[model samples]
Target: MPYALYYWPTIQGRGEFVRLALEEAGVPYDDVARGPEPDGGVPAMLALIDGDSVPHPPFAPPFLRAGRLLIGQTATILLFLGDRHGLAPKTESGRLWVHQIQLTLADLVVEAHDTHHPIASSLYYEDQKPEAARRAESFRNERIPKFLGWCETVLERSGGPWLGGRRVTYADLSLFQAVEGLRFAFPKTMKRQERKSPRVVALRDAVAARPRIAAYLASERRIPFNQMGIFRHYPELDP
Candidate 1:
């Protein structure tokens, strides 16, 4: 049976991270939430959380359903998929290290999401512009460099090509997504900082060039980044 991925239909959001791994691994899966209601759409996604079919419900979207297993949380899902799809190292320590890297990336994703919804996720961007500006300023100045610099260091330690040494692991895919989101959300800042993180930039490019990943990105299956997604492009906040 093909794996079933449940996430919001419209935006890339956290779901995109899982999608990238599946694509890179050439795994055939059903993007459940993207289908029609009767065939598992938004209602199906909500049912997983609000209904009782799943004994262990996920608190939010981006959960993967594989046979009897239901996995939630972006990092956790990626860790599971990474091991199963050979997108992680063979050693236990290496897998844990990759999972640790993914957790740190998750931290970056949350901070980036907060750039627009700093005060409250319930509030609209227009309602929280001032606070968002402040949050975004700090993110652009401090957080972006810190996270990207750490990724660069990891790549340096790996001695090139991929985060898992010569192999392109899920961590590498997540890092590419992070770079893409950061660039879209903070083009000005990313452009200026890219000079300092050459390895990180190269990794992003390498991931983009992978056969399956490249095809998936070019296909309509890849959702575009928008205001509703985690990485929103607000010109005022970025500047």
Candidate 2:
């Protein structure tokens, strides 16, 4: 059966990472909140989350319901899907390496999210813009380069068109998502250093150009990035 992806309806947010892999692999799954059927929208997502159908419930968005398995956490869900599907490398070492990359990507994502809400996730950006600004500065000046540099090193060592050598793995797709999110949120930083991260940028572009991914990107199904969600682009944050 196709997986049921539970997440917010409007923002790409964390769900975009899962969406990228599913789209690239051309996997048939319902993006639960964004589905065309009326029974498959936000209400459906809420019901699933609120229901007692499963013993282990996901704590947050971007969870996947595949058969009897109910999985949460972006990295964990991706790792599970990557292994069950062909999106991960077959070898144990390769799979472990991909999981490592995915986990690191998850860390980068949380940091990116916190840049706009450094004080607290529950607080509004307006409520903590000053703290957010402070965090953004550090992120732009230090965290961004450090994370990107590690990814660059990974790419360099992998000798890849993809993170896992020749094949397109979940790590590569997640990396593309991360690069996309960062570029959206930190365009100025990205423009300044993207050339230095050639392989990472290339992977982003390649993921974008994949037939299904490209189509989804162009389609109405793909949600646009906004001020809310993990990667918010503030002009001041960039400059």
Candidate 3:
């Protein structure tokens, strides 16, 4: 059966990470929320989420359905897909190491989202402009460099090409997504930040150049960056 991926239609958010992995794995999957009704759409996702038929229920968007198993949490979903698709290492230690990198990218994603919604997700950016500015300023100056620098450090220590040394792990794809979002959310900041993170930037470039990834990125399936998504571009917030 094709993997069923449930996420918001409009926003890439955390779901994009899973999408990238699926795309890279060259596997067929239905982006449930983006499809037509009956078998697809947000209602279908909600049915699975809110319904009691399934033994496991997801708390929010970006869950995956693989046959009998229902997987939630972006990292956990990637872990499953990684093992199934050779997107992670063969050994337990290597797999855990890649998982650790993905979790770290998740941390950076949370920080990036919190920059615009520092006060609360329930509150709009307008409601938290001042707080967002304060948060964004710090993120631009400190967090982005720190997180990206750490990525560069990891890449350097891991030899050359790919985060987990020779293999192309799911974490590599995720790091590319993180950098892509950061570029969209903070283009100006990333311009300077990229100078210090050449390997990180290069990895992002390399990921983009992959045949499937490149096609996926160019296709209509790849949602454009917008204000509503996790990576929103507000001049005030970015300024």
Instruction: Output the number of the lDDT-best candidate.
Output: 3
Q: What is the Å distance of residue 224 in model 3 from its true position?
A: 0.5
Task: Report the C-alpha lDDT of model 3 over 94-211, residue by residue, as the tens digit.
Answer: 9999999999999999999999999899999899998999999999999998999999999999995999999898999999999999999999999989989999988999999999
The ten-residue window of minimal lDDT in model 3 covers: 230-239
Local distance difference test scores for all models = 0.92, 0.86, 0.93
* Whole-model lDDT, model 2: 0.86
TM agreement with the true structure for every prediction = 0.98, 0.94, 0.98
Candidate 3: pairs in clash: none
Instruction: Predict model 3's lDDT versus the native.
Output: 0.93
* Residue pairs in candidate 1 whose N, alpha carbon or C atoms collide under 3 angstroms: none
Candidate 3, which segments miss by more than 4 Å at Cα? none
Clashes of each: 0, 0, 0
